[model samples]
Target: MLREIYLSTALLAAFGLVGAGLVALVHMGTAERIEANREAATLARLHEILPDGEYDNDIINDTTVLSHALLGGGQHLVYRARRNDEPVAAVFTVIARGGYSGDIHLLVGVRENGQVAGVRVISHRETPGLGDDIEASRSDWILGFDNLALDDPPMERWAVQRDGGIFDQFTGATITPRAVVRAVRDTLIYFDTHREQVFTPIPVDPTDEEAHADE
Candidate 1:
């Protein structure tokens, strides 16, 4: 009976190892294709928010990820679009955590001049009817942010009407809209202050160049 038990255990271990190897092989084979699909979808969203003919550079190739307060204190991707090697616009994703139900993810486009080109809610877990209006398809409230700037609405006036600002809150959801408004404001401010840094090209390392040459 003991020998039979050992044999069963060995068989189970071998099967587990084989399953893991197959999973790894599948992952390795599909990784690049999956990444390509993801990148394409991201670029589609980026172009949707940016104004037509605003940029000609390969925004996907000129991307950077940073962990900062404006981006919900987590890693966020920032895409830079340029025309003739000159900066034209920036698209980035940010999160608003004060939603009615949970955090809201937003994609924001800002022109080189600091004005917002457009904003879109990538995903959110806010109340179904109230917070869902933040989406462009459901309501036009998000359109109000187009062409907005820091001083146009004024930093102090970046709240909903109940708080004496210009934006309108949903019929039953004040917290959601207010949180979104503040998030856009913060994202704009972050880009405005970091404009030079954002547009700066990353310097190639000399050591890496030598290593590549050796290879």
Candidate 2:
């Protein structure tokens, strides 16, 4: 009986190890494909917000990280768009807090002159029919932000119309639209304050240094 118990324990341990190893192998196999899909989705959103042809450089490769309270206080990726090496616009992946259900993820593009290029909702948990109108597929409301600037609306009028602003709020979901409006405004302010830093070139890699040294 003692020998049988030991054998059972050994088989269980071996099975556990095999299961773990299989999981690791599956993860390793899918890792690149998963990352590639994520990158493609992100690039699609970027193009939707910033538009194609307006940028010549590889926007995905030319990016910088920004962390600020206005940007939801977490490190956010800022993709800079340029034509012929001149800055065209900067697209920010920002988080909108205070949503009705939860946070709303956004992609806001601002031109070099401070005007808003466009805005797109990357993801959100707002009410399907009401707050979901903030999405381009659901409504044209998001397009109202195009070409707007901090001064054009006088900044204070950036809120939803219910709050004495130029934007509109969903009939049954004011919090979600309000949250998105505030977040977009904050993102513009963040970009305005850090335009220079946003466009700053990324540092060289050590591997590149080694390759150059080889020459």
Candidate 3:
């Protein structure tokens, strides 16, 4: 009995070590490819948002913790769109809570002029027929927000068509769409308020500051 237990324990330990080694090796081998794919996807998204010229930096999260942008001005905005040295986009992945069914995931593009360039629905669990219309594929309703400026009108003016506003709300699913609209508006407002801070480079750590002071 003692010999059997010892053998079992040794086998388990060996298996655990092998499993850990495989995991580490897989991570090491795929890290570069995963990063490259992320960079490619980010660049594609940025181009879809700007589509004007080539950008060099990955300025995502520069404006907001969850956002990024490419920082050159042309006919359209060009953001370098990078993560570390790997290129990516200056994009925001926004989560709008309070939807009728639940939360909605939206990716919103903000132009340099503080206008909304476009919005894409990343995911949602709203009432299928009623709330899904907010998606780009189901309808063009979400596109109504494209190029809308914050100062264009009052908050009341941002409601859906059923509520007598510029946008349209689904027949029975008003709350879900309404939540998304409000969230988008709030995000834009946040961007406008923090534009300069978002675009600027993050401050270096205190260690760097102390080194400078010493110098």
For candidate 2, write residues 1-215 as lDDT tens digits.
99999999999999999999999999998998999998898888887887778889999899988999999888998899999989999999899999999999998999999999999998998888889999999999999999999888988899999999999888999999899899989988888888899899789999999999999
- Taking all chains together, the TM-score of candidate 2 against the true structure is 0.84
Tell me how many residue pairs clash in candidate 3: 20
Best by TM-score: 2
- By lDDT, rank the candidates, best first: 2, 1, 3
Candidate 3: tens digits of C-alpha lDDT, residues 90-128: 345677778887868777777667778777777899888
Give the best candidate by lDDT: 2
Q: What is candidate 2's CA lDDT for residue 197?
A: 94
| Candidate 1 stretches greater than 4 Å from native | 1-29, 205-215
> Which candidate, 2 or 3, would have the higher TM-score against the true structure?
2
- Report the lDDT of model 2 for residue 14: 100
lDDT of 1 at 99: 89
* Candidate 1 Cα deviation (angstroms), residue 84: 1.2
